[model samples]
Target: MQGRVIYQEHIDVLIAGGGVGGAAAAAALSQLGLRILIIEPGPAQGRRLAGELIHPPGIDGLCRLGLLSDRSMPGSPVKGFAIFPADKDDPASSVTLRYGEKPGTRHLGRAIEHRILKDHLLETVQRFPGVTAWIGARVTRIEENPDGSFTAMVRSNDGEEIRIRPRLFLGADGPMSRVRKLIGISHETRRYSGMMGIEVEDTHLPNNGYGNIFLNSAGVAYAYAIGGGRARVMFEVLKGADSKESIKTHLGLFPPLFRLDIERVLATSKPLAAANFCIVPNASVRGNAALVGDARGCCHPLTASGITAAVKDALILRDALSESNLDIATALRRYSRRCGRLELTRRTLAEELREAFLAQTPEALLLRECIFSYWRTSDKACVRSMALLSTVDTSIFSLATQYGTVALQAFRLLPRWFFEKTVVDWHRGVLRLVHKSLAFQYAAIRQWLY
Candidate 1:
């Protein structure tokens, strides 16, 4: 519409990268009476963070954007998830914390646990009459014109580069985005420090219906349920925790995990956190462009909510654009302001939690002990903590405050030494026997009596 009429008769919006974020934005922009183009780098081969525990807010956004309904027309639905203290030594010692509770705005977020789930999303994109999704096309470069339009240089899988000009071009590309750099945006690296995300499929864990968190004293791992009775095991190796043997030992701790014996899954998964933690600044519309999803930034995967965070950004971006006229600057600005506030809270809390889990001190040990006791007993505290992570609290700060209050209350109610012995000296002497007795009862109730 402004620079060259190469893309369309009247190019309105162009979304680069057709992952969840790009597709969601494209669908939203269509409601604004704009023709959309979604340029995805690959076909079904699009590489994404495969393990997703799509939370309630993310599911609600999908419904609102007309992307999915009750049955996940495109993807699948998961009831909820469970969190384990990843640093713990024993699988039986896991605290199965479920994010969804009974009827409320806060329910268990359905998880999309595999790469094939992308097929459902891709199918929906294919059927969207108002949008064009050019799959297997790689976007190599972008040119922001003086008058505020964009010229994207996209290369087909066959090495043919085509230039298309669109009024508002978005880079929904993953963490390594050229679009942000072209705009000269410098990102501040946060807490990625020294960690890597390795996703592998394990077939023996259908009972891991939701995402299962595993945090040993060394690092943390997350397992999300996928199709075909499969689950993805993501091991986040912390600083100085990067030996193949260490990973093997951690996997050995879970008897259920070992039964699968799927070593190939570990060998293939990509490591994202190997890069320094950074959030590109001024990623919003510099002139008439938008940077959505990980092209903007990503936090640690400890929350298992990165994919949802990206989708939420798209939803908010769409809302901002649709509600107001296409003054691209204002719209993109809104996307930045809203997403920053929203993601910052999530990321900050996750970093804090990760740090605490990674710490090896008496206070940290005490906290870990308390959490594990609940894991052993399946208590109210576990339920409440799960609720807080999903959508119940809404405010991250508030959630922490509430959890602290509950911990204090639980301490006052239960005998201090009992919790201390069971969690603190968990593997030795009377505490070991005490936990053995209590753990047996828990196993029975969870297995038989519910």
Candidate 2:
């Protein structure tokens, strides 16, 4: 197809997606006297409902970005998370996790829609003098120009088309980013298969302040308290059958041990259904185009750090752009530098956790159980684990190293099997870290885009 923009527009920065990352980027850039244009493809038909668990920093990011300015919306202020690990049936079931009432943490999921947050961000963009927001527009092709700029060809629902040329392009587009692919940036797409999440609420949970995970032979369920006498129940359904039907057929299968949460879930499952997912984990940026949120990399939604990670990407990129020489390429390079040096180790850790958890092997289940036990017992370990999820520090590796050492030490206090299992998981984790570290170094030294 010949690339032609039916209408032409100019913007200092063209952001391809207006979710958390793109919206935050536009808001930040708008403050700097830049004309910003945002293109967001609205929710797809039968859109995936985000059973996303938001952290404190995510809530902060929304307020900071002006997306959740309404303090009264019970739907937007999460103060904590409650997690149940392993089979809730085992009165002594291990691998149950919780994160509330911690020293520095506050609030959990605000029971809000990601779409609402995205729309609010677009609204924030409109407040900027030179910002223009376009919903229902999907950028299909991107033409990278030789003058350090690019043109994106986007199509709207009404079949109208437009071309946007911007000095800088930010592809907050998403996990399946067309611009990132057009820029020749490939992602190691990891299908987080064999898992499903269902939203159900009936009564106040064990503790809404913390997120819960149920690690059983069937699969893992990460229960997040969504506030207001409700929580979202996410678990693995039987693989390869119609998952929703499977959930419906098996709704009464929750073991006798978790009768409270189970009964409530069964009581309130009237509007609940299963949402399947996939995630990207390889690269976060490419030349002028960058990815964030589920866009850059999505690990197990069990982590539920989507909002935090996306918002943080925009924040650091904002800083990277500000501190650098203002050269678009250089600034983007710095941004990539910041992300990799800043996030790779922890990201690798998360990826390793996924690999270990996917198979539901005895070792994986045991270790998951042990991790839940450790985190619940130690405040420091809780903080360390929480920090890794937040990805707020550049030295997450150091923090993880210290915590892993501690974890290993504590694990040694247990059976030898647990230690060996952790070590095995690290084999994959460390290799990923090394690979990402090298990738970042190469990008820094060579500036190779293609």
Candidate 3:
């Protein structure tokens, strides 16, 4: 294979995977006069429904890449989010978060089709003279030279193996990043149960412009408007079975969790199923190679922050490279220091937030309700939580502050909860609750603070 292969060199940066992250980085870097080679395994446009919700910060990042203009991509404008506890049909039990309510934040999130945004970014990359995009090309392997450059083996569209030697290598290859593995950057990944999504049309939700999440005993159900009388509906399903069967069989397991007709919606549209997953935080840069997007780290999908985080990574990395004279080592160090802090806050919030809503234990259920109830009363809580979810603010201190308020609310409701349960040793129970809350808070904050 080596004897037959053609070698291509003098490339400034080689990007693996031309998804949003890779394409955005190519566009940003090419503008600086660097020759970029982006290998994409998929077709020219993405087809998955995974990354539909672009939070406010993600929109800002797109604008920075010059992808956004006065004329927006075809999608719905999302004002915020609405969360329903247990009974999705009960409007009174729901709490809302509006992005406009937050200070110093963009007023809307864009709920567009994953393919639309991806194609738009790829098109933007093509407009740049220095970017060479090869769709249907896969990166087979990457080798680092002694002088800190890289040689990559790519299987191109016509099944020809080619070698590319580039000054820097970027892995925007998503959660299962081959570049990360080949480069010897260790990471941890776990796929949670599973989730099913269906495209809905001609039906509007109660909070039409806001992403809707319904919490119940079975699992979590989510729906958001995408635009033009269409929406995306997602729900948790049992793991390890035929996804379609799981969806059909388990759809009836829970009560009507949303305003739409569940059976009608599922029957009318094809379902997209995926397992919920988490990637433990790791350094974004290693040696001459660095990772962006899900390659670096991923939060639980429930946060809907994955896309925003990926775009942010690309933007920050572009800034670092531009400022550091294109020195891979210096640029990566700067990116690492900045993204490390952001990753800490994101991981902590994603973990804690998942526990508060999705955990199955009775105690966890109680906490979920308490937190929901707290949000209903606290205006600031709603805005701050939205800020974190939208990635508008990725500060651990700010996260601690918001969660501290939740803790206080939890404590205030504990006594009444105990009294209603007719518990023996109620005082002891309260003390235990307080001790546990403080310990959990300390544990979460300690990791980020250090």
Candidate 4:
């Protein structure tokens, strides 16, 4: 399957995938006066159902890279998140966590449609003096040179083969990254659930300017405006659950105010679906090649941190390279080490939140209650939780502290359950909770020290 190379070129960096991460990387690295080439297998205008929501830190990163601005950005401003607990009878009980309410945090996030955001980033990067982007082109083969440089064989949409040699290679292709595989970096993927998304027009959220999350026994539903009066509603479809039935059940869980609008959209348009999975890679950097965005790793979308993490990855990579004086090896090592810790915290928080929100076990249910109670009663708790959720703070120590606090609060409520259950059953649940808490603390400590 050796294809004749029709064109050959060299660049300082070759980035595979022209989506959010790749585009941002090119934009950031271009400032270093490095020649960059980006190859995207998808269309110039992508219509994929992917991460659209960006946390504040993500917005900050894009702004820092000059990829986003108030005049140029195309998206709705999200003040924060409003969460509706499962089976709640009253909408007033929903808790609203607003950004900037916590001191020293950014004021808002953004929720642009995935396609629009990707196009904007790609276009922005292409205008840079040293950045070139190829639409409908992909890297088909990669070979390492004796000097640790890379030669990649790219195939354009029309079958034109191009050869590129670059000092550094970045894989921002995605979770199922061919670059990662070709580079011999193995990863483990765990399917958590599935998501179905439908766009409804001319509808308004109950808490306007805030992302709304509805939690139910079936799973979680997210509703928010994407921009220009269009709202996106996404529902989680647990494994083995019928997609049609899950959509219906989740729609019913929404407030009556906009359920009709969602139903109308659902009837007229086909939904977009994506798998919810977590991927942990054995390594994010190998030789002269490195992985960013989901190519490095991904977590469950329950925390809505995909785009946020992707943007952060680019900024971190930029800083590493700049700090290491453009030494690819040293820069990559630094990026890998720092991002490794952040990924650990991101994945751990997402997993914990998923279980607390969806798991039906006694311990999870109690933990959920404690979480809600903590948010409602303590302003500082909400601030801390939102900081972690927004990736403004990725400290393992803070995570452990937050979890320990909630576990203690849960323990305080165990006395009420003592009378409702047999002593043995109640004791068993408490023991399980304690064990889990202790295990998490130990892991956090170990990760912190290492």
Which candidate has the top score in TM-score?
A: 4
User: How close is every model to the real structure, measured as TM-score?
Assistant: 0.76, 0.77, 0.89, 0.94
- Tens-digit lDDT track for model 2 on 338-412? 666545544555655564455565544544544565666676666566556555443644544543443443343
In Å, residue 260's CA in model 2 sits off its true spot by 8.3
Between candidates 1 and 3, the TM-score winner: 3
User: lDDT ranking from best to worst?
Assistant: 4, 3, 1, 2
lDDT of 4 by residue, 53-158 (tens): 8889999889888999877789899877899888557656888876655467567999999988988899888999799988889999888777765678889889
Tens digits of per-residue lDDT for model 3, 107-202: 778888777778878877878888888988999987776876567888989998888777788999988889888887888887776777777662
Question: How many residue pairs collide in each prediction?
Answer: 12, 22, 0, 0
Candidate 1 per-residue C-alpha lDDT over 78-100 given as tens digits, one digit per residue, 9 for 90 to 100:
55555555543445645566654
TM-score of 3: 0.89
Better of 2 and 3 by lDDT: 3
Q: What is the lDDT of residue 335 in candidate 4?
A: 95
Model 3: colliding residue pairs: none
Residue 211 in model 4: shift from native, Å? 1.1
